[model samples]
Target: MGKVTLITGASRGIGYALALEMHMRGHHVIALARSEDKLQALKAECNDNRMECAVVDLGQPAQVDQFISALVDRGYTISHMINNAGALVNKPFGEISASELRHVYEVNVFSVFELIQKAMSVFADDIHVVNISSMGGFQGAQKFPGLSAYSSSKAAVASLTECLQEEFGEKGWSFNVLCLGAVQTEMLAEAFPGFKAPVNPSEMSTFIADFTEGAQKFIRGKVLPISSTTP
Candidate 1:
C-alpha cells in the first residue's frame, strides 16, 4: 500500500478534489465525510486500489471514535492528515447561540485535535499536518459582523497552529496554517455569491496536496488576498 492520507470532509468540494489529486498521484486516499453515499460514489469513480472511505462526522466524538476503531481493526496507518471538515454560520454576534458556537468549534478545531490524537497511534517517522485556517486568522483582519463565530474559531485554530509548530518543529513534524480567500466551493458560494473570489478550490486542493509532502514546516499568515486581484 502507498502512503496513506487522511482527509476529512472528502465527500465534496476542496476535500474531494484533494483526495482525487492524491489518489491519482498514487497515494492511498482515506476519505472521511458525513455523506457515505457521496464517498462511495467517489471511490467508485476513482476505482484506484488506494482509495478508501471512512464515514465520519468531524464534530462528533462518537463518530470519530467509531471510525478510528474500524481503521485500527483493519490495521490502517495514517501518515498525512488534512483537518478540512468545517461549517459556517452567518449571524449577528449577539444573535449567535452558545450551542451554535460549540458546533463550529467541534468541527473546525476540536475534530482536528481528536484526529491528531488518533493519528499518533499509527504515525510514521515523518508526518505532515495542514490545518486550514482562513484569511480571518491574521491579526487586525476585518472579521465582519455576521461571521464573528466562524472568524473567531479560525483565529483560535491559527493560534493553535503556532503552538503546534513550535512544539513539533523541533521533532521534525511539520504543521502549516493555510489562510484561504474566497474559493469556488458550495460554502463560498453561499457565503459570498455575487462576487466569487478567483481562487479555484480544485486548484487550491491540488496545490496543497502537492506542497505537503514531508518534513514539518511552519507557514503562518492572516488575510491572504487570494482573489485574482493579486495574481
Candidate 2:
C-alpha cells in the first residue's frame, strides 16, 4: 500500500495548508474537518485523486470512531497522523461554563486520545503522530488571560503525547508535540482580534510538513516549542 497521511481540521488555517502540502508531496492525503463546504473547497483546489476529504466533527467521539473504522474497512494504513484540530474559548476562568470546558477538552484532548487509540489498527509500522499544541501549553511559556479552558486542554494534549511516546517508542512508532506560538490563522484572530501574527498559516504549515516527514527519525516523545514571539 502507498503512504497515507491523515490531517484533522483540514478545512482551514494551518490544517488546510498542511493538507495541500502533503498532497503535493504525493502522499494519499485524508483531509478531515466538520465543514463539508470547506472540505469541498479544499477538494476542488486539490483536484487530485490522491486527496480524500472527510467531514468529521472531532468533538464527536462516535464520529471519530466511524472515521477510523471506515479507513480500516478500506484497507488504508496511515503513515502520518496530524492532530491539528483545536477548540478555543476566550472566556475568563470563572465565567467559563462546564459545557464550554467539555467542548474544549473534547476537541483538543479527548478526541485526540480516541482517534489515536482507534487509528492504531490501521497505522503503518513507521507511523509518525504529530500533535499540534500551543505555546501556552509549553512549560515556562507566557500565558494569556481568557484562555483557561483552551490552554489547559492543550497542556493535557502535550502531556499525552509524551506518555504515548514512552509507551510506544519501543515499537518504533514516533510521537511528538509541536507547541506553536501565534500564527495568522482564524483561531488566532478569534482569540486575539486585530493582532497580526508574525507567521502565516502557509509558512507554519510548510514547517510542520517538513518536521512531520523528517523530524521523526531524530526526535520522539519530544515537545518542541515552535515560536518566535510571545502570544
Candidate 3:
C-alpha cells in the first residue's frame, strides 16, 4: 500500500488545487468534501487511479469518525493529513447567533479534533498534520469586523495544532499551523465581497502543498504566517 495523503474540503478552492498538486507530485490522495458532485468532478479531472474522492461534511462529528474508521479498516496509513476544511460566518459579533457560532467551531475546530483523534490508528510513522488557519486568527494580525465566530474558531484550531505537537512531537509525528492571508477563494469572495486577494487558489495551494510535504524537515510544532497581504 502506498502512502496516502488525506485532504479535507477537496471539492473546490485551495483543497481542490492541492489535491491536483499532490497527484502531480506522485501522491495517492484521498479527497474529502461535502459536495459529492464536485468531488466527482475533481476525480474526473485528475483522471488518475491515485485520486480517490469521498463526500464528507466536516461539521458532523459522527461522519468524521465513520470516515476515519473506514480508513482504519481498509489498512490505510496516512502519511500526510491536511485539515483544510473551514467554516465561516460573516456576521457582526453582536448579531451572530448561538447556532451559527457553534456551527463555525464545529467545522473549523471540533471536526479537526475528532478527525485527528480517530485517525491516530491509521497514521504512518512519519505522519505530518497541517492545520489550515486564517490570518485573522494569527496573533497580532490585522483584525477585521464581521468575522468574530470564524476568526475565533480558527484561533482554536491553531492552538490545537500546537497542543497536538507538544503531545506527539516525541513520537516523531509532525504538526504545524499555517495562518493564511487573503487568497482568491470562493469562500473569501463570500466573506468579503469586492475584495481581490493577492493570490489565487491555485497559486496558494502550490505553496501549501510544497510546504505540507517538506515543512516537517525543518519545523514542527510551530505556527507560520503565510501571507503577502493582510485582508
lDDT of 1 by residue, 1-231 (tens): 558898888888889988888888778989999998999988998986789887777777787778878877878776777878877887888998999999988888888878877667766556777777776655665566678778888887878877876776666566776777677788776555565667777899877787666424434322233334311
**Candidate 1 has which clashing residue pairs, if any?**
138-222, 174-216
Expressed as tens digits, the lDDT of each residue in 68-171 for candidate 2 is 88997899999999999998999889999999999899899988998999889998899999999999899889899998888888899999999999999888
What local distance difference test score does each model get?
Answer: 0.75, 0.93, 0.91
Clashes per candidate, residues 3 or more apart or on different chains: 2, 0, 0
Instruction: Determine which window of 10 residues in candidate 3 has minimal summed lDDT.
Output: 56-65
User: Judged by lDDT, which candidate is best?
Assistant: 2
List runs of model 1 lying over 4 Å from the truth.
Answer: 214-231
Clashing pairs in 2: none
lDDT of 3 by residue, 170-231 (tens): 89999999999999998999789999998999998889888889989999998889989879
- TM-scores for the candidates: 0.89, 0.98, 0.97
List ranges where model 2 is wrong by over 4 Å.
none
Q: What is the lDDT of candidate 2?
A: 0.93
Worst 10 residues of 2 by lDDT: 57-66
